[model samples]
Target: MIHPPDRPTELGPGGDNAIAHAMGVAADEWTLLILRYALQDGVRRTAQWQQVLPISSAVLASRLRRMTELGLFSPVEDEEGAAYHLTPRGAALWPVLVCIWAWEARWAEGHPLCLPRMRHLVCGHQFEPCMACRTCGGLVEPREVTGSFGPSGSWPRSAPNTTMRRRSSGSANLGPGFFPESRALIGNRWSAAMLGAAYLGAHRFSEFQRRLGAPATVIADRLRTFRSLGVLEVLGDADRTDRHHYRLTDKGRAFFPVVMSAIEWGQRWFLAPEGPAVVFRHRGSDHPFSVLLLCSACSRPLTGKEMTVD
Candidate 1:
């Protein structure tokens, strides 16, 4: 049986906060786009990425440099000039990408471009992806999973200081398969942190501010954005400011698989001396939560190489 920590563990600069570390590396819209193209379209050359993405050269270069430093992409010199390939670490993000696609396909409405159909090669069927617990080999749900923080959970130690690109007015031009809501929720570190806090039962406005140590204005802006996106709802006394309780909507809760996949990936790739910043356990099996992306059609575990976007 799993037990809660006796006291919050404090993480230093080199602390092991997998989720935050992962967010620092791949949570940006540009990074996500680059990974999506590389994984789905076999994009490698810098020129190829420029042609496919609406990003500027300077920003693209910056993203590539940072991603390479983060160990996601490896620079390769080929016969045809310079190119980038997903390192094993980068390629492991396939499940996180697939979960985003699956969520957007189900919840997002009236998108200008149709999302691609995912084909599971093993099952030979076009299907949706589902989250399953690797230990028991059973389907997992939001309610069945419990998350807790470790020493790396503190905002100061875990928050990524990378400068985020401000949301552009021309988001619609981001082409097909871009996850706007997911991007809003996860691309920004503060937004992702607050959402993670919410999942861990942080409800009041003060609670969010206290736990994240974020500026009140930024927290307020994110709360408003969450409400506008239908991911969170404000409940309780309308007139009383302190009584307002922020809660995740059903839509918000549905993002669990993406979060879990990211946490699992982070834990695997980014290690901290203090240990994992977050821990998730399966309530039904009382075992460590191990996320497995399974094909909705055949219920077989899906791997990066075995799935194709069509």
Candidate 2:
């Protein structure tokens, strides 16, 4: 029998599982689109978000309220209406957003609108953000990082409540200039967990099933989606489905920064009794891996205040 936490921990923000907590709030398609519009277009009011996004007023209000309760957004009542601004915690998600933009711009196909150019104001040049180690000041990649789970990192703790309904395929109608592929991969809790498991050395289909505790059909569906997105490749005998070894493709490996940034954001905002749910270490420096987003043009560290998207 599948045993979840004692409480209904699906969408609520309080939890010891930091990664799960982070995903709970930020890893939804609506949340990502809202954040994009807010950060890039300086959208703050309810009417403003509605004008830019296709989301209903009730859903937008609900998301805003939840984000406010989670410390990501603070609501201010004004003469017109309530305007929500990103808190420091919310502002810290700049790197994650930038990483998503970078991945989608580079890998995703058939964008209906042009993706915005991210400019580093300090360097006065448009650049792609690169992930680097905070300790040794070196570049970080999927292979160079090692992860270990703490007490809170159990599959039960990490898995979202399965009772939560999967999103409809047509629900992601965020107009143009939005992240479709990035949202497809990271926006879903199960898909994010499965991808993370792959990075943590879960290669075979059985391994993914074992680690994620997802249903066989759910696992299969996500694996197929990953393969279709060019994020994973099946090795060994294709006919032997059970023994098929799944590995990350180059495009998949490039998504490491997005994961790292999310992990860092989670560890920073969500507190667990057993410390961080998952601890990552840089192999070359052998130090705790801290994600630093740097500009490709000037190699300088990036901040939300310093970046202008156009």
Candidate 3:
């Protein structure tokens, strides 16, 4: 069982696992898109989804089923066909999506997909964070977050038994020691692209490499990184030697939102006239960047200036 980060026991309203849960939900790209579409455009049958999203039928089914099991979506049956709607737990993801989008819009190159304006629900502001917060209010830097195995955990099967696990603390003692393995798993240009490709349903290594046009060595490196991080794993007895056909592990699946948020950030800020390098949306509101930042103890809005540095 995964020991979660330190969070208020009396949750206002959210899933049990929080970080772990969200990571699982957001781990894949299509899953986030499924949620985003439902949230933004309202519920539509799976067929409708197939048009806008290029994901394969098998992958879509898997994503929908996983999300349903996680309580992010509730099955709704109607004349058109069966569709899914966001639950409260899923709806809570908007802020995270929005924040990520805002970041991307600024830092990354963008195309028409990257809209000129994004509405901040909190302040009813139509400006970017740089202008809204940095110019007007102030800036809030992302806490260099870390992870750990927590009180009860086990090294993955592939991980070295004597692997050196590094411990990192948040600005405040926000959580347990962070597992550095997680970063080595995902922290790379190709790693994120791999996840993004998965979100778009490019499963095979050749497909990923062809679409991304990355070097074979780069692809192999990312795959190995994810494997060691326990994010991706070799599936059943089929093609163990090929090493091209792999799927996301439960751990990697949970980390989707973090990747999605990051992609959304890239999409908004980094997109050029061509198009977004990546795009992500909130599963609930399809609003992206809906989660709030608050104190673990007081649950108060934790601002950048408010944090006391160690």
Using lDDT, give the best candidate's number: 1
RMSD of 1: 5.8
lDDT of 3 at 23: 38
Model 2 CA deviation exceeding 4 Å by range: 1-16, 162-167, 171-175
Order the candidates by lDDT, highest first — what do you get? 1, 2, 3
Model 3: lDDT of residue 152:
19
Relative to the unseen true structure, what is the C-alpha lDDT of residue 262 in candidate 1, on a scale of 0 to 100?
Answer: 81
Measured against the true structure, the TM-scores of the candidates, in listed sequence, are 0.89, 0.90, 0.41
lDDT of 2 by residue, 113-232 (tens): 767788998989999998888988888777999988876676667655432222466665544657778766876678889988988999998899888888999999999999999999
Whole-model lDDT per candidate = 0.79, 0.77, 0.44
Residue pairs in collision within model 1: 9-151, 16-272
Off by over 4 Å in 1: 1-16, 163-167
* Overall local distance difference test of candidate 3: 0.44
The best-first sequence of candidates by TM-score reads: 2, 1, 3
